[model samples]
Every structure is written in C-alpha cells, then in structure tokens.
Target: MTLFVVSIILSAAMLHAVWNAIVKTAADRTTMLGLVALGHVIPGAAMVVLLPLPAPESMPYVLASTLIHFGYFYMLGRAYAHGDLSVVYPIARGIVPALVALWAMIFAGEVLPLQAWGGIALIALGIQLSSWQALRSGVESGVGRAALGYAVGTGFCISAYSLTDGLGVRLSGNTLSYWAWGAFLHLFVAGFIGLRKRNTLAALRPRTWIIGIGGGLVSMTAYGLVLYAKNFAPLGAVSALRETSVIFAALIGFVFLKEGNWIRRLGAAVLMAGGVALIGTSL
Candidate 1:
C-alpha cells in the first residue's frame, strides 16, 4: 500500500476500533450493535437516490455481500455477548488477516513474497502475543473463556464475509454499491434476530442515541474509507493492516478508560508495529 493509502487505512482502523469499543462499553450491547447497523442503513439507503446504481450484473455482489454481512452481525452479537473489548477485540480482529491471506493465495492466486509472508507470520504471532500474558495468567475464567471462544468464532465470520465481499465488490465494479446494499441486509438480519429474541427495540436511554449516532457515523466513515481503499490494495494487505485496530483499542482503553495492564498493552503495541512494518516494507 502507498503511504497515502496506508494512512487512510490507519485512520479508518482507529474509527473502527473506537466504534466497536463504544459497543463493547455500551449498557445494551445487542441494542447498540443493532442501532449501529440501523444507523448505517439509513445513510446507505439515502445514497441510492443521490448516486447512480451500477448495472444489472452488479446485483449478485450486492446480494452476496448482504448475506455475508448479515452473518457478520450475527457473529458479532454473539461475540459481544461473550466478553470484554480488550479480551475479545484483538482476537476477533487479528485472526482474520491471516485467513484472508491464506484465502487470497488459494483462490485469488495472489502470492506473497517471502519477506511479506514472514511479516504476516509475525503479525499472526503478534496477535497471539497480544493476549499471551492474559492467556497465561489464567485470564479466561468462567465467562471470559466462553467469550474467547465466541469471539474467535466471530472472527471466522469476519474473515469469510470480508473475503466474499472483497471478491464480490471487485467483480461488481462498484464497491459502494455492494457496501450500501449490504448495509440494508445487515439491518434486516439484525432486526429479525432481535425480534426473535424479543430484544429488538431498545428504549434508548435519554442520552444514548446521541452517542450511538456519533459512533455510527464514525463506524460508517471508517468502513467507507477502508472499502474504497481496498479497491486499490491487495485484499490480504488491506485485511492485515486493518487489524492495527487492536493497538488503537488498547491505547484508547489505557489513555481514556484507564483500564488494562500497560505491559500487555505495550507488547500489543510492539506486535502491531511489527505487523505494520511488515506491510510497510512489503509495499
């Protein structure tokens, strides 16, 4: 990725981490997830009129992206139900790039240079190191262990959907079309799940809507920027760099929330830096 592209990806990663942290910190996790989905839906739905939709062939990508994204929502909800942002976020975000890289090699016929592959290995190890201390400390106790499992499962969906969406959008010739339509599907799937559980309508706390909307806007901007950039970059490269959000989330927790252990966070920082250096040098 070019510096400009990398910078935009980093900015989007920050926003991505922030919004998820917002959900992870929320009083109503599922509702917060739903609202974020709903928030994106309105904006995306609005874009249909203001911009011209692509040709008929683009619809498959749009539809595929929608279904895959719905899977993302479902997995994310279950993952959030399981644990803390610090514990779950890194695993959920970090693991996908490796998978994306592998998937790209198998299907996309995109081969990584030896050095780049090494860097990716480092990233994989770094992600594990991010949680190394916690895992060793017997950190996952009771619910935390369950959360870890759920979160990892959610990460699988992240990888699968992203891979599918990346291919879909690239084929569609207009990534925004796929993304906007996917937004609608996400909300629809979220709504159905919510209603089935009788947890659909959250009576927003008097002030929560403001925060939810703020988070949603950030979330949307981040996705838009990343998806646009993904169009130019290798899918694996894009996926790997996005995992930098783990470091950002750790910093946000430490600097703002005054939570988490610094030593582990510092280790995460180093791992993230390694991942970036890998991509930076590779590019």
Candidate 2:
C-alpha cells in the first residue's frame, strides 16, 4: 500500500472506532442505531439526487451489501449487550482481514504475497491482544460466551460487506456514486429498526438523538474512505489496515476513557504499527 492509501485507511479506522464507541456507550442501542442509519440516509438521499447512478451491474452488489449490513447491526448490538466494548470490538474486528482475504481469494481471484499475509496475521493478533484480559474474563462466563458468539457473527457480517462493497465500488466506475447509493440503501436498515423501536424513539433524550446521528455521519465518512481505498489496494490489505480501528479504540479508551492496562494497550499498538509497516513495505 502506498503512503496515501495507508493514511486514508488509518483515518477511516479512527473514525470507525469513534462511531462504534458511541454505539457501545449508547443508552438505547437499537434506537441509536436507527438514528445512525437515518444519518446516512439524509446525506445519501441528497447525494443520490445530485450524483449519477452507479453502473447497472453494481446495483446488485449494493443491494447485497445493504442486506449484509442489517446482519452486521443486529450482531453488533447483541455483542455489545453481552460484553464490554474492549472485548466485543476486538473479537468482532480481529477476524475481518483474514476472512476478507480468504473471500477475495476465492471470489475475486486475488492472491496476496506471503509478506502481506504475514502482515494481516500480525494485525489480527494485535487486535485480539488489545482486549486479551477482558476477553478472557468474558469467556469464563455464560454471558461472555454469548458475546463471543455474537461478536464472531458480527465479524462475518463485516467481512461479507467489506468484500461486497470492495467489489461493488470497483465495478461501479464511480466511487462517489457507488458510495451514495450504498448510503441511500441504508434507509432499509433505519426503517426496520425505527419501526421496531417506534415506541422508544419518541421518548429518547435530545442528546441521544444528536450523538446517534452524528456518529452515523462519522460512520458514513469512514466507510466511504475505505471504499475509496479499496479501489487502489488489495482487499486483504485494506481490510487489515481498516481493522486497526481496534487499536484506535484501545488507545481512545486508555487516553480518554481511562480504561485498561497501559502496558497492554502500548504493546498492542506497537504490534499493530509494525504490522502496518510490513504491509506498507510489502506493496
């Protein structure tokens, strides 16, 4: 990956972490998620009106991605319900790069070099390490096991959508158009959750509304950047780099939330940075 691509992905990773953190902390996760989806719809609707339609072939991928995101949101909410952000976030994101790489290899016929594979492995390891202690504790309990299951499910959803969007955006011929369409399709997600949570929506505090929608906008930008980067880099490389959101979340927790052991956070961050360096050099 070039410096430019790496920079874009890293920025996306940070923003990705931020939005996930917001969701993790929300009082009403489903309602908050619906608002986030609405956030995407607002901007997406405007852009769809202004931008040309994506290539006809790419519409199928866009539809497929939207369906996958429904599963992603559901699994994410379930995971957070069972485990702490430290535990849930790492496990959920840690598995994506390898899964995406495997899917890309099978479906897209994209085989990465050995060094790049090593980098992805290192990133996966570092992400898991970031939440090792919390994960271990969660595993020893029933709820933790439930969290583990849901988090793993979330990982699958993430990988599926990442590959879907990666291929979709590449074929779309216009990244912005593809992105806008994808965002606009999120209306389904918002509507589904909103209808289910209608009774609760009217009771939500103003703060919750603002934060949820704001996080949605941030999430949109983050994924938009990832889709843009996928156009230039291999899927596995981009996925691994993007999963650095785990590291960013850990750092955010340590610095701002005053959570976790410093030694562990620092160690995980170092490993992630080294992994990034390897991937950057491999290309």
Error of 1 at 113 (Å): 1.3
How much lDDT does each candidate structure score?
0.73, 0.90
Could you estimate the TM-score for every candidate?
A: 0.88, 0.96
Candidate 2 local Cα displacement, residue 103, angstroms: 0.7
- Tens digits of per-residue lDDT for model 1 on 231-267? 7877788888777777787678778888667887787
* Maximum-TM-score candidate: 2
Clashing pairs in 2: none
> How much is the lDDT of residue 36 in candidate 1?
76
* Model 2: lDDT to the true structure: 0.90
**Candidate 2 lDDT by residue in tens digits, 132-220:** 88888777765546888999999999999999999999999999999999998889999999899998998888888889989999999
Residue 108 lDDT in candidate 1 = 83
